[model samples]
Target: MSSNDLEICKRFAAERAVLDREFKGNVVVGIGSGSTVVYVTKCIAETITRMNKEAEKDGRKPDLNVTCIPSSFQAKELILRNNLNLGSLESFPLVDWTIDGADEIDSQNNIIKGGGGCHTQEKILASCSKELYIVGDYTKYSPKLGTNWKKGIPIEVIPVSYVAVKRKIECRLGGEVLLRMAVMKAGPVITDNSNFIVDWRFPEGIDNWKDIETTLKMIPGVVEVGLFIKMAIKIYIGNEKDVKIYDFSPSNE
Candidate 1:
């Protein structure tokens, strides 16, 4: 296969190999929404089939029943397409693992997600997991999240609250905020749930990011911010040569 084809398949295969080793029998998995994580779902499907085939050859029933929880409508569709079992948040309270991608990851391991407009559900699914693993390419790693993911912080809000929420982010917070327009193919870029997205920007050299995140969340119209703080347990980075894993344990640096 060519490099372009290799890039698409190789990265997903590497991530799948890691996940297959981590997930054994009867695992509860969270499927995150994004282009990179789409490969993750595909990997899970192949792994499940391999396990089932192995059991058939041994004349034994496979106990590797995988239940997948989706972070978005796109994720839900992928789950069904892969022939994997599906469950809702209300049905499965806890997940064994969550595999996701990030917009950016810093030294602290805090991330910026929501590039697919599924920030709210992604956050919920990630928190429900026992261990959350982020799978992505080297381009996503950054000194800070907003530094590389210059798309700005994606904030999901109630439809009626868009105007008020925009003012709070731009005026009250003294930062730049803009209403995300529908550029993909339409009048407005409506989300799966028909909610609007507002991207917020802070000064280039922001000192207190945590404080800013806290302040923006306090706004009434805001539903959820894209700043994912202390959610990932480990990150599996896909470099050109190989895949490297990083733990989110406490560290001075």
Candidate 2:
């Protein structure tokens, strides 16, 4: 297979494994954004169909009730296209599990998301979830943050405060701040929250992720930071042949 095809196969493998393990019973699930997560929604829909069919065969009521909460507009469309029940944080309040794709995942499982400009809602769903699980191909794995994902840390900021936030992140935080521009539109990319994204090209070899995350969030007008420190309970990394599971352990600290 070609490289892109191989990568897609890996993504499907990892996403399928995660859905098979975590998507069960009557539960609300948070669906994350990104290309890899496309397979996640597909796998979940397939699972639901299979389970309901089994129920029919056994002459039992279809009890595989699963409601999907989307983390972005793209994710919402995916859920609806797949014929899955759509829900919201205001409605579900608490999610049983969240499955997302990360731009990069370090050995500590500290992840950099928001490559799709949906980190704000992604973080919200993650915070509301009882557990967060990430699925990605081998290319996304890294020994540390910034080792693989080079675009920079994605920060969602208020539209009016984007300039100020960019300046602060550059001056105080010491990084190349860039306003993420739109591909088709004329100006900067607008997030689903109507905010703008600033990609902070931070230097590598950083020691503290949690401190930086907190400091970034403390900045006024900053909606959310893409740095997810110690939030994920597990990550399913798909290699060429199979999926590798990374379970977070406090001892790794």
Candidate 3:
């Protein structure tokens, strides 16, 4: 297949190999919102369809019922496109596995996501999954978090409380805050749940990001931030030839 970058295809292939090899039986799959995760979603649907067809050819049919819960609207569309079974978070609170794409990943496997503006829901789904795997190209990897992908942290804030939240981030926190505007859409960049997005940037040389994360969450208007602290179970860093996987655990800290 033709692609803009050969590495994209390789990353998709590697993720598929891992999922097909590991993920089996009645699995509640979590579909993440992003270009890279798109491939993983496609693989899940393809595997289900293939299994169904194989069962039809045999004397007995099989029930390859893989219920998928999506992270965002984009994810929902992908699931429908593949003719995969759809389930809601309330229906399927626990996911067998989740594969997502990251904007940046640290050595400790912490991630900075929501580049697509699905941070809040993504974080919830990622946290609920029994195993969360992040997929990205070599550019998303860093010795430490917040090195590359410098669009700041994507913060989900209440629509009515945007101004106060912005002030708290800019004036109180001494950071830069930008309300994400709408370009293609009519109104502001509305999330799947119709929430506004605010991108916040802080100064470099921070020892404890956990403190900053805590402070942001304490803000009344702030719903959630893109800083995925210790939520990733594994991350696949796509490079030339093969993909490198990093295991995240508190024991490493």
Best by TM-score: 2
Cα lDDT of model 2 by residue, 110-174, tens digit:
89999999998999999999988888888889998888788999999989998889888888879
Q: Per-residue CA lDDT of candidate 1, range 1-253, in tens?
A: 4557536544753465346455566778888877777788888888888878999999999878789999999989999998889988899989988888877888777788877788888988888988788877767788776767888888888788888998877787666877788776765456666788888876677656677779878998777788888777777777666776777845622
Name the regions of candidate 1 deviating beyond 4 angstroms. 1-21, 184-186, 249-253
Better of 1 and 2 by lDDT: 2
- Sort the predicted structures by TM-score, highest score first: 2, 1, 3
Sort the candidates on lDDT, descending order.
Answer: 2, 3, 1
Clash pairs (backbone) in predicted model 1: 182-189
In the range 90-169, model 3's lDDT, one tens digit per residue, is 99999988878878888865678888999889989988899887887777889886688678889999999999999988
Which residues of candidate 2, in runs, are more than 4 Å off? 22-24, 249-253
Between candidates 2 and 3, the TM-score winner:
2
Query: Per-residue lDDT for 34 in model 2?
Result: 90
Backbone clashes in model 3, listed as residue pairs: none
Q: What is the C-alpha lDDT of each candidate?
A: 0.78, 0.87, 0.79
Root-mean-square deviation per candidate:
2.8, 1.9, 2.7
> Better model by lDDT, 2 or 3?
2
